[model samples]
Target: MDPEDGSGWADVSDRSHRIDDEMDRIVERLRDLAHTQRRFQDLLDAVMSVGRDLELPVVLRRVITTAMGLVDARYGALGVLS
Candidate 1:
């Protein structure tokens, strides 16, 4: 069989397609990890902000807002204690 025949070309093409598909999957995984890492960092930052405040009211406000923001919510509430 000649190297330039259809069989050899088809084999090379199939391998190339498989490699491309694998590369796509890897890229998607990295993108997912990046998003997860960003979310984790945001939560960590929110925790640090809450910790930096000693006052109860400020801490409560930070907690409520951070929770809302993390979930992309437009509303949140914190009860006040008498």
Candidate 2:
């Protein structure tokens, strides 16, 4: 069996296709991660702005919400009073 025969070529082609597909998926995930990071940064900035402009209770709530959102947590609490 020659190395360049149909079966060998098909095996190589299949492996190449799988590698390409995996690379494509990895690139897409990286892009999504980058986008999510930028969004998170924006949210952080918004939280900072709220904290700067609002009173203590509002600042604490906004900061907690921002933290929860970034961490994908459904709920959060902060002990800001004491």
The model with the greatest lDDT is: 1
Which stretches of model 1 miss by more than 4 angstroms? 1-4, 79-82
Clashes of each: 0, 0
Stretch of 10 with least lDDT, candidate 2? 1-10
Residue pairs in candidate 1 whose N, alpha carbon or C atoms collide under 3 angstroms: none
Model 1 C-alpha lDDT per residue in residues 1-82, reported as the tens digit of each score: 2576668788788999999999999999999999999999999998888899899888898899999989899999977789
RMSD of each: 2.3, 3.9
Against the hidden true structure, what lDDT does model 2 obtain? 0.81
Pull out the clashing pairs in model 2: none
Give me the runs in candidate 2 sitting further than 4 Å from their true place: 54-82
